[model samples]
Target: MSLLSVRSLTRSLAQRRLLAIDELCLADGESCVLTGENGSGKSTLLRILAGIDAPDGGTGCFDGRPFAWRPYPDWLRKQVTYVHQQPYLFHSSVIDNIAYGLRARGVPGAERERRVAEALSWARLNHLLDTPPARLSGGEKQRLALARAWVLRPRLLLLDEPTASLDADSRRQTIELLRTFADAGTTAVIACHDRDVIELAAMRRLDLVDGRIITD
Candidate 1:
């Protein structure tokens, strides 16, 4: 069975249907690049999958267990990670920020540091470890967010336009990091307008139009 499955999913706000996905399934270690225009429900689907928002009506299964429309269980929440288009950075050093999630989860001091280090290596942000968020560039901040998520080692990584406004070099770096995630067997659902992200080997393309998936 797939690690994540959604059946008859629908999300509506103020009586307007935002999404109506009949079925979607993601096997463990699989990844999909979600392409859609603004307000086309790409972000909504990520939010719902990440369990940050509840659907209007749906049946979702994680690891073969069922979940109704509501706040997710602690374990389920831990299994999903969502990075915003403009991820919020706390007022702190880069390394400190990356280590925040593990710390919150009460991961041991040594383990947190170790995982943070691994994340730095994964995102290639080691040099920026000690830098303050104010001093970092847009791409650096984006990388920092990705590293932060990496440290948690969530089962499903949701990225919302992670490379949206980056420079050429930054975009290249971001794409490389995503490729590393794929190589490591991390299941990721990336919602973006950039086709460059589709170059990742694990990524299968899916388009969202008028709140419905148009799979080919």
Candidate 2:
């Protein structure tokens, strides 16, 4: 069974149709790239898949069973995390921002420290750990956001324009980190306009047009 599946999904906002997906599935460890123009509902579909929004019509299943949004299962919650285009950090140190997820999941002191350190190293933000996240550069902020998601070791990750604001070098590094995560069996769905990211991800590309998937 697919790790995630959506059947006949549809949604509308403010009396306007936002999404209408027939059937989509993502296998364990698989990655897919969602590409489309503005107002194509790419982010809307990602939000639905991430469980942040409900579909007006259709069913979603995890491992062949109905998926529930409330009181999220620990296993499932740990398995999926979403990173938005504009990341928000707490009014605290960068270390605190990256450690937030671990604390929320009840990970204890030592383990939390270890995971946070590892994530910072991976995102190349080790030196800025004690700095205020708000003071960091745009690339650093994005890296902090990615580190937050990565430390959880999620089995599925949904990224919305992850590298949109980074410089060339930073964008390359971010893509490399994403690839490493995917290689370690983390399924990913990325919404992007960057050709480099799309090519590097080597994911099945889908185009959303006016709330519908456009067939090639």
Highest TM-score against the true fold, candidate: 1
* lDDT of each residue in 121-154, candidate 2, tens digit only: 9889988866888888888888888999999998
Model 2's number of clashes is: 0
- Count of backbone collisions in candidate 1: 0
* Index of the highest-lDDT prediction: 1
How much is 37 displaced in model 2, in angstroms?
0.8
lDDT of 1 at 4: 92
TM-score of each: 0.94, 0.93
TM-score of 1: 0.94
- Residue-wise C-alpha lDDT for candidate 1, range 85-180, written one tens digit per residue: 988899988888999889878999888888988888888787876788878999998899989988888888999998998999999999988887
Q: Which segments of candidate 1 are over 4 A away from where they belong?
A: 201-203
Candidate 2 stretches with Cα past 4 Å from truth are: 69-75
Name the weakest run of 10 consecutive residues (lDDT summed) in model 2: 67-76
